[model samples]
Target: MPTYQCFDDLQLFFKENNIHPNIRFENMNENSIFSMVKHNLGISIIPEMIIPKGLESIKVIPLELEQTRTIGLAIRTPISPAVKKFTEIAENWCRFDKNIV
Candidate 1:
């Protein structure tokens, strides 16, 4: 897993489930984790959106626990029309099913 903020969350999940992972590798990013898993190094938990859908060498499994990451849009005050529209669209997009968000 990443040695960043996300690792804290993953650690929390592990603790909650009383899981003691014998972590053998650490990486800074998802692509490296994917590469490691692809090479049969070990399994990793990553955001579902990142898994390449067509990768036949790997299997994707859904976790029973639902996890979410916060996302944001940064715009200065006095927002332009385009920014306002984009924020509106983004808000609506997030309100939909995950498949469409």
Candidate 2:
């Protein structure tokens, strides 16, 4: 998998599951791991946000652990009224989806 850094969680999963594969850790920022998987180098566990278009070739195997990340909106002071309204609308739109925070 094209990983930016050594993932301890992944290592632990491998140890617990007895999975040993040829591993090559590259600079994480160089490219997304999905790109490496597309090149047929190896497989990886990645967040869903980075998955590219046309994902039919890639098989996404779900992990048992509850992996979650928090996201927030940042606004500079003296924000325009329209911008503030848009932010509130966006937050409501996101909240409409019960699965998303």
Best candidate (score: lDDT): 1
Candidates in order, TM-scores: namely: 0.71, 0.57
Report the C-alpha lDDT of model 2 over 1-101, residue by residue, as the tens digit: 53543366566667877778677754465355666676887777766656666788778777776565566789998999998998999899778957567
* Clash count of each predicted structure: 0, 1
* Overall local distance difference test of candidate 1: 0.80
**Which parts of model 1 have CA positions greater than 4 angstroms off?**
72-75, 85-89, 92-101
Candidate 1 clashes: the total is 0
Cand. 2 Cα-lDDT: 0.69
Candidate No. with top TM-score: 1
Candidate 2 at 81: error in angstroms? 5.9
Report RMSD for candidate 2: 4.5
- Residue-wise lDDT of candidate 1 within 49-90, one digit each (tens)? 667778888888777877666767888999999999999998
